[model samples]
Target: MRNSTALALAALLAGAGLTGGCGGASAPGHQGTPPKTGSSDINPQPRDSLRKGGTLRLSIQQWITQYNIGQVDGLQGDGASILTLTEPKLWFADDNGVPAANPEVLVSAEVGTSGGAQVVTYKLNPKATWSDATPITWQDFATQWKTRNGSDDRFQLSGTTGYDDIANVERGADERTVKVTFKQPYADWQTLFDPLLPGSAVDTPEKFNTGWIEKIPVWGGPWKIGSADKTSQTITMVPNESYWGTRPLLDSIVFRALDSTAITEAYLNNEIDQAPGRQPEAYRRLAGAANTVMRTGGRWDETQLTLGHAGPLADVRVRQAVTNAVDRAAIAAAQSAGLPFKVNTLGSHFFMPSQDGYRDNSGDEGRFDLERAKRLLDEAGWKASADGKTRTRDGAALKLVYVVNGNGSTDLPQLVQNMLGQAGITVELRKVPGNDYFTKYVNVGAFDLASFRQVDNVFPSLLYPVYRTGGDQNYGGVATPEIDKLIDQAGAETDRAKAAELLNRADALLWQAGHSVPLFQTPQISAVRPGLANFGAFGLRSERQYVDVGWTR
Candidate 1:
């Protein structure tokens, strides 16, 4: 669910996910360091070398209501950990985030120039079909483009990066082929039409919004939803009998929704096969556990505070003040403790430390200074309370609710609350159930400050949706005209280095405006059971043969 094509294709972060880091660790071993780049601790074995049947049990932070990742309500972080199993991943990416056609769904994708525009033609596998036997055709591609191209206000979307540049999607060489002509040059075009939604599911605004709620009605991947029970908070995935690729080696894959604490216990009790112990506290707890291998790698994610565009946060000075009030280095140190790598405070929104374009563009705005924080808040006209407590303006208290999905073992919510309080702002901590966190709150901008991880993609320009004005994914809704132009130029630039330069320039503006407070990049810390092939901390790589994941022979 993460990669790059024209722009970057990415996912949300859920659970107690260990995020962003530039360095890699040693090969996975008992109490050993996390694996480095070009190495994923998933003991991958060829299908012939794997066992016939087994269940890969894993835990997720929440149960998701929406099944479509393209929709606003559907873009849960844990939702990503499951959708690749049932949806079409037309392109598979390598460790470097370079994408290539997947033979199961695509035969070839050729790029060419058409009448001053860039056109990409996709050749679909004639054998590929949805779970209901609907062939994977040009219609599916056309529907996705229509729904996600930012031309329609009726369709609720997560983000329209590459899709926004599409001029049209037409059938080419019959129904199994699609030719997408871009309105402008989209440098990351290879990322479009991925996880292609069924045409019927998004043909209309009504169907697009509600068709996939609480149900996965159609699928075109290695596995199908066997059962999705909210009562049990578990999703059971079985092999898709109609899948036109290598048969899935495992009999089933089960995902159980458990809180952070429960997931830790489930792994230690041997009830689950994989556990994410990315934070220092949990990482130490699971380290050297009997019969477990701790796979560590570069996590291309940064935990941050997404400020709302509305309310008092709309003031740039207030946003910058709140950002400066928090101690990012302390949080990084807390999370990095006992880890084999040094976790640096994240300073860029678009690139992770592992990527080439990464730069500390934060400048002085990223530093922690209580005096500066108070000065900025005071300058913004939020006067300190008469009693020397919270700030007040026009007889109203300057208060904010910090919405969180899961209170990680790191106690990040508490730390942020205490620090913001010191700056004379009353921070209220509200814990939402994982299932409702995005749909009920964050997506709608229900909090002043929301805590989560922003998973960076290989292509920096793909972040346009997260930073551009009126972009749906820009939950904070903070953007200057200068930032927008830089992001636009970057997204259109075909040159990688030039595009990275433009992105960094735009990132500098975001820091000045306090779009988000980047805490630190996370690490891929997972305690995986022995012999679980092709499944572990995948690091910068996003593709895995879900069908090939099984117990090693």
Candidate 2:
């Protein structure tokens, strides 16, 4: 399973609180081209048009087991998605995932260097307080730092990228101000504190990992947990009376856990007000529904193939052959066929095709060339059997176990299996429980190959935990000194241009190493009530203002 910290930060930044600003030129010091408005199927509704006092019933793929996003058990995307509603970060991203100061939580945040060390000072809004009326303080910041800084293994932190580099977290003259000093420069420091765990949650290891299970003892955002029913597979949330920002327009939000297969039906039956339109059949079904609008856009999440290094994939040639054998374009077409909007195959591992700095570094390896794939396998000593249906090396057949959570359409994996079989590769499909898929298979290296999607970050530093050696989310167990040095160099560089160059260089090494194969970007698809404001499939802007999502008239 991915660590809670990096996953939380990525989900938060990619899909946290919303900010105001139209598309503009790339920010100074940032690399890549500026974000494009791009193709979107969502019908925009003005915030002022929304009415107040209603409950929004939403569908979630999985029931959350842990309330704290900082713990390993709570690192799942479903938990992070829920936390976005209940936990407010000091800094949030605009619709484009651009880091923006959140005045609701922080009055201002300034970054600079002092004594050759990078420093960040945050000034909190005086009115900001938790649900219990506890004022957010420097203690909260310090508690989070100490608990997640990797000093104590018992805490089970999701990541230690920026936290491990932190030398000290000091409070200023008052509780409203806190200063953070990093031993080395962390260019993406602004992305650090959105899903900040409260002092009560992080004060002890037991509290950090177990206290938040099924119960949210603290709240810092616009809403507070009202109740959760495991039997009903539902969680209810109410407006936080202590909230200092705009009062939430909706009386409450009910997140109901539903099977992915049943989500579209739930939407159709009026059991849920919104459902993701990822499946073409679902989108087509929802398209004709009354009082509903189909929204589609380029999502930050990218589907990829992760090969385990400890199993049959340990041979780099095998990984390379597999990469060349799969046809990404065909896969994208099959997934998006007959859909309302077109979807594109993702080329880069780090940036989206539309984003700045994105390049097709996959080279010839990404193409679907069975000849080259077979040649590579032959070079690696995997000879075709007499039947020519599968390859064998030293009497052991080239069999690969492909595992996935039994959710949504199986077309992707089934297609991959069929394609690989044509190239004499035997792929065994293993479906795991969606709830334990990450922890049981992906995290523990229980399968030869796995398929999953990841949301990209605005800055490259967020990639550290996924590609760096010994990273908490390094699924493939890729460890190389060259890769490590390049990643560290990129993280420490203050100059965005230089960092982008270093990141691109490092990406080349990743492709050469065949760490993972980039498949295609999942089109952000959703069916929403026509009057539903501030809620739908968004591009770089994934965060929604929970307080503002409601019906219009």
Candidate 3:
């Protein structure tokens, strides 16, 4: 199981309310030698009439969970991908998923304390404007802060442990200058700076504060929402001519829903350009085909096992037993041919080990051992049931419902269920639609166990929502005062050394407590057509989207 903070974030982001409208911008001529876009470097190409009007089909197993930017809780990475196709954040990660010091939309971003609240300052790009020709300004940031930071559902700042210190936000006398003041010192302030919301979108501060989450969002990105097929399963986007950044290469992009088997077939038949959620080896098989190219996926993107935080699961012995009972090496092999890395620790309060704070605890606490698992359960006062397939205490059977994305491979949970069975644990595998599945089942803490996956970013973005107690994303029904303290400090921590120390300590604590069972870190490798030059970051957050990419000869 992953940590509680990430689960909370997923639940909230699943319902984000964002609206987009884009037009064409002036194109820059091509410049650099033709190179893969998803590679480490941002190869700049000069402006020209891009290979326009070719339909790029994308098959992402599930539909986008939510449209709201601030309210979105769980699917932050997926939301980021969608925004890249339709909007621009003040500070976005470069092609490498590292936060760009200055993006095209915002000139600079810095965090500080103001009146006992964490304050974030944003300087807007003079050329940046919404699709409707509204210039992005400080008023927009202030209004977004007022609306999202003020709401109960909004997970952007104050409500989340990452931003618990943010007190308020205000605009400077100049429209381009804005400030966000926090309630306490937060370490993860950068999480809110990206994909900024527009002021024009929030005309009624009351509406936003009152849960009118359906409001159409105003966006400033390369593409705009062209045709939303609420009836069918397709969503079409066209290049926004008024975009402040480089003119988009493609005329239109389509996001279509397809079954897993059909997605692979579509890629082979040239019906789609790409598909997300395919296993690493499966993606490897299709890469470098006649019309396709494949690349390696990144860290901290894959399936996870979440132990319930409360009720029967709150027991440390139960959590430890579950962790040791499953063989992650086998699970990783089943998912990929040893391509995915085994993670034995409860995910660092944040998802990625590459981030500033990460500690491996799998060696000591998360080792796979059915005998030890049985011993732990026995010590916890559980004995075999009459059927010998389950453990019972005081006549109550140790039963768990394991939830996972039904559209993906069934082998993921089946392997886990089989492993747990060896320890006499009865796990009921429940497969559901990936779209908003986290929100429906995990968010409400409705299930006993859940197969989880989250796209991790630079640092602390997914922390508060996943770990903090009562966190909207805390679907695991679990929390610890120590974990909470470490995560909260990590959010406000500005110094790299201190933040890393706190996060490492927190990761160790989680493993000791058996809060989550570490699975493998999934890769972002995928197949792409040869002509597609810029693939962007190859993970969950930055997938095979065409936002910061184009064709080059």
Output the TM-score of candidate 1.
Answer: 0.91
lDDT of each: 0.76, 0.74, 0.59
Model 1 ranges with Cα > 4 A deviation: 1-39, 385-389, 406-410
- lDDT rank order: 1, 2, 3
Off by over 4 Å in 3: 1-53, 72-80, 95-97, 101-103, 110-120, 150-163, 200-216, 276-281, 284-288, 338-356, 385-388, 536-548
Give a tens-digit lDDT track for model 3, residues 1-553.
Answer: 2222121001111122211001111122211111222233222354352454566666655555454545533243444456555666655455445665446777777766555555677777888888678788877765655555545443332243333355656676567777777666665566664556566654463433323232235667777778767556777878878876766667787877666767777778888875432364454345324555443334455466778866567688888889888887777656544222222223444545454345665665678888889888999988976665788899988878887767667777888889888888988888887665655776667777886665454455454666566665666757789888887677667787887787778777777777666576554444555556555233323432355466664
Give the number of the best model, judged by lDDT. 1
TM-score of each: 0.91, 0.91, 0.82
- Tens-place lDDT per residue, model 1, 1-553, is 1211100000111122432222333223213333443345555677798889989887776776777778877766667557767878887777777777888888999989989999999999899988777788999999999898878989988888888888999999999989999989889887677778788777888888888887777888888889898898899989989888877888998888888778778888998998876766676677656767666566566677888867788888899998899899888877766665556578888887647778889887888988898999899899997665699888888898888775344288889989889999899888877557666787777888987766636556556777888877777788889999999898899988899899989889998998888887766667787677787767667645477788977
